[model samples]
Target chain A: MAKKKSESSVSTVPSPASSRAAGVAPSHTDLLRQMLLIRRFEERCAEAYALGKIGGFCHLYIGQEAVGVGAISALRADDYVISSYRDHGQALARGIPPRTIMAELFGRVDGCSKGKGGSMHLFDRNINFLGGHGIVGGHIPLATGVGFAIKYRGGDQVCLCFFGEAAVNNGAFHEALNMAALWKLPVIYLIENNRYGMGTALERASAINDIAERACSYDMPNEVVDGQDVLAVRDAVLRATQRARGEHTPTLLEVRTYRFMGHSMSDAASGTYRTKEELEEYMKRDPIIVLRTTMEKNGEWSDTAMTALDEELKAVAQDAWDFADASAEPAVEALTEDVYVW
Target chain B: MPVVTYRDALNQALQEEMQRDDRVFLMGEEVGVYQGAYKVSKGLLQEFGEMRVVDTPITELGFAGVGVGAAMVGLRPIIEFMTWNFALLAMDQVVNSAAKMLYMSGGQFNIPIVFRGPNGAALQLSAQHSQAWESWLAHIPGLKVVAPGTPYDAKGLLKSAVRDDNPVIVLEGEMLYNTKGEVPAEEYLIPIGKAALKREGEHCSIITHGKMILVALQAADQLTKEGIRVDVLDLLSLRPMDVEAITASVRKTNRAVVLEEGWEIGGIGAQVVDYIQRECFDDLDAPIVRVHQVDVPMPYAKNLERAAKPDVPKTIAAVKKVMYLDQ
Candidate 1:
């Protein structure tokens, strides 16, 4: 948890907009700042989990930052988003305050779910971020239903559902995809294929090597994009969202990324399942570094700017930690509230 | 008053609610084109159109989860399982998603959804197809469960459950669907947590819900011939249970007989027994007795099925035992 150095070397690179790619958002600085803030916030979470400040299954979004930043960047604020448990990155990118996410992780009243839902289940209705669900593939059908509601009401809004590669084999996934396809619901099913379902590798779990090909079973369009590349992920998601909004069709997208940390804090940097060489290989394509290197090479970023932004975000994470630490546990009487709405 | 089948009453409730609100829609297998497997939704597809009266594949969990998701975004969905037995596949969405969404979201989203369908044994369906789901479904804290035995209660409870602003399980009586009852020709809504006095008496109280109301009434009739009058209380809703009504009935009669169509252990009768013991123990003149389906998988043979099922004779015998009429 010390100050980390930049991993990507600066070279000639194209700007986000020029390649007609999902490259970067309109502002290079903002995209860089957003992804870095998530990195810093969750690094603190890892530290807290180690110290027992945060409990339960805490999964960090350490290495796979670009997929969240760029994909969410393509979505309008009105669009709905639902994610699996490794959700701090997407929640932060969706513009939910770092303090709220941090507080929820700490199990405080100020948390989005008022501490009723700990690390796994985070919900914010105001921003249309549906939730961070716990069950593996259980939420895919829920997302498809959100799309059904949107279409039923004739609303142009779409939903982006995030899940891991591990969820593909689940019956819920297949069933949801089939319905989403049959009904032409406006949902973007984004698979963050970090290559492991806990300790089991994707190759061991799935029959097909290409996760996006599973979409063919439902006759849905799909894309396989570089999850490490902010622009590429954004571009693919932007196209998917366009298809969703304009045509009311669903798309399945596989964002190939890697989890730098173990699946959860219970497992360390995952040396048991993976090798140092493989870990180093994925570490080189780290999302933050990939985006920063491109921007710096384009003369849109600098070492001074990166250092200043890093400090600012670190303070933000610290303030969030302080807020969560100061917030009280939920009142005892609240135990029975919200079970039913009279 | 107009005499109508329970299925017709339920149909009227769905038609009225859908006509009243644009957000309410029905989704299930065979609900639209086939007009419901039990014909509970007959003529609905033609009236409401295919969009509102939807038919999904045999994906119980898929459609059920879809209903939960749709409900989260402000639409009121009525998800019908073909039977309560098939709802086992959809319990994940019912229990995990619809029931817990509000609490888990810190009270942000109230899943105003209703899961409705026929429940309990019908003839000799036996085993997998025949299950009285009230006990298991009622166990969930976030869900409001209701079982209506009469046509009047069915119409009113289904209408109310659609608007309850929480996940509700409407355990419709499969056998009672074809049975005729006098329903008032006017609008009415039955509150989800009250019991109805089907027949009032003095010697004892017979508490039941759904189809067991008929058994309780029949038993009460024969008991009257034996100079043993009893009060038959029909518990329409299980979760926001009408404990006050139960206490009043048990306190009045001084003896209680619980009748249900489900298994004995951890049954609805057991919960009622717990409530009665805690509330009306001193008032009781005799130990309470329960008449429920025998503690075994429903047998397929006609004789074994009739023996396993709790019928009017079982109810009468249970009441007589509590009243000390039969040694």
Candidate 2:
């Protein structure tokens, strides 16, 4: 690997705010822009899936956009993030282009993963967005080990692992948390407690109910945050990120939120476990609405400006879809490709 | 030629591979300071330190997932399951995560890892710890399953597995750990998907793997003394099974018997029979006979446990049945 002068000096992140939670704070406009991007990107994904443009299992982050936007907004570019299948928002928030993501959903040759990984499988090493793991609680240990890599390499990088509240009951969750806490690895376990685990209500499914409380068994600091509030979620993640890098301790955060969409494309949102009214009730506290109301109250954004921003994002999303739609399918020869060193 | 036990050959392979490449390391329950309950990873922690040769907490899913991640990030890891029976706990990580990473990642990540340990019944280890999991693992497409019976294949295949660019499950025989055999004194790698011929003959073919290969070989020798020639073929790699080798041998011998130490019901032998029937059914003079372990929970008594699994007598009986020796 050659380290040329141009390549070495070329920083991975453009905005200084993309690095640490340093003195270079992001403007309100930048915050709103990134948040809107994630929201619109996921909305387009859902629509594309409905149009039969996307294939495989698709888990949309429709109502839970702020969880990824706020959490990722608080970290440095060097910090790694490992999340579960509902990761379109995280990928968009982490600066992966909507075009590449859309192409991936379309299984196109131009996709980020070259049509190999569909909805549930996404990876971008350059941005350090590890993957959209299909298996429940599978990537928890991997995130812990990534934190170990940072510490081993003698860097201050932290790893933020995100999983649904359902993963808390898995054996891997317990095993990974114990190891991370025991090693004092710089990792933060974020639980997006959306009150439902694939049609099963959290209250009925989990005996403990409070996922954060599970972290106390490992003697790790646990925090519960309202995931719909962007600033609050950002503040909580920033605090945990600081503790992880500074004190060398792992923290578990229970982000109280809800998903408007079903577990996957095949799942119908309206079902026996949850009512339409419950879904509508969660929509009232939607992360996008919370951010928009906050910005309106502070006079940081106006309805006219918001409308214009929405129009711009709509154009971008439309362009992304068109770009993905026009992209060629992978070659027939590619079917037997990438299995091994062949 | 150097004489080494099957267990020592595996340990030497791990040590040599770890020394040859910094990326290679071992992680399991007591692989580190505990020196492995089986004592296969003895002196590893002292030699490689806690960073490389790690003693993970009793967390099979966690450590296996960690190994998958490490492999994704350019490290070759050998995850030990004290026994393959315990791997049931980490099945998701092995089957869903490690096996599917390359395909799932759209080819961005290839997990060059090996999950190795003892697999079948050795003593009265009983139901929980004595069952063979090769059939279950071989069911998945993205995985490569290897079961080496001899010290030479154990060392060579392990070295190849450590360096190969895919996930492999190396199922070693627990009872054969102390069995000594001659091994070469140079670095060699037996490629995956290659079968080895333990003995050559023309009358009938015996296809088996792992510890069953020894049993089959003994049966072949006994039959040879009785003036009946038997070709003994060791199907080391179970997934990309040496179907061509077995088919070619059966086409020549015109009769075949599949032997396995696992349960007869839906075992690796059943899979081989299906493959052989599809590939060389026309060449068969007699129906393919499969000698497999009795399908039942291995009892806690030594005699019952030995009786439950396929043995030399069972192999000889199956061969005799195929050869029409009763007449």
Give the Cα lDDT of each candidate. Answer: 0.89, 0.84
For candidate 1, write residues A60-155 as lDDT tens digits: 888899999889888876789999888888888877777778889888899999988878888889778888888898889999999999999999
| Model 2, docking class | medium
Write one digit per residue (lDDT tens) for candidate 2, span B1-327.
Answer: 999999889988999999998878898989988898788898989998888888888788888887886676667889999888889989998988888877767787788889999998888889898888899998887889999999999999999889888999999978989999998888789988989888999989999999888898889889889888889999999988988898889989988999988887788989988988898888888888998878798898888888888888888888788878756
| Model 1: per-residue Cα lDDT over B212-310, one tens digit each | 998888888998999998999999999989999999999999999999999999999999999999998799999999999888998889999999999
lDDT of 2: 0.84
Chain B of model 1: TM-score? 0.99
User: Highest lDDT, which number?
Assistant: 1
Q: Which stretches of candidate 2 lie over 4 Å from their true place?
A: A1-24, A265-281
Top candidate on TM-score is: 1
Candidate 2 local Cα displacement, residue B255, angstroms: 1.7
RMSD of each: 4.4, 4.9
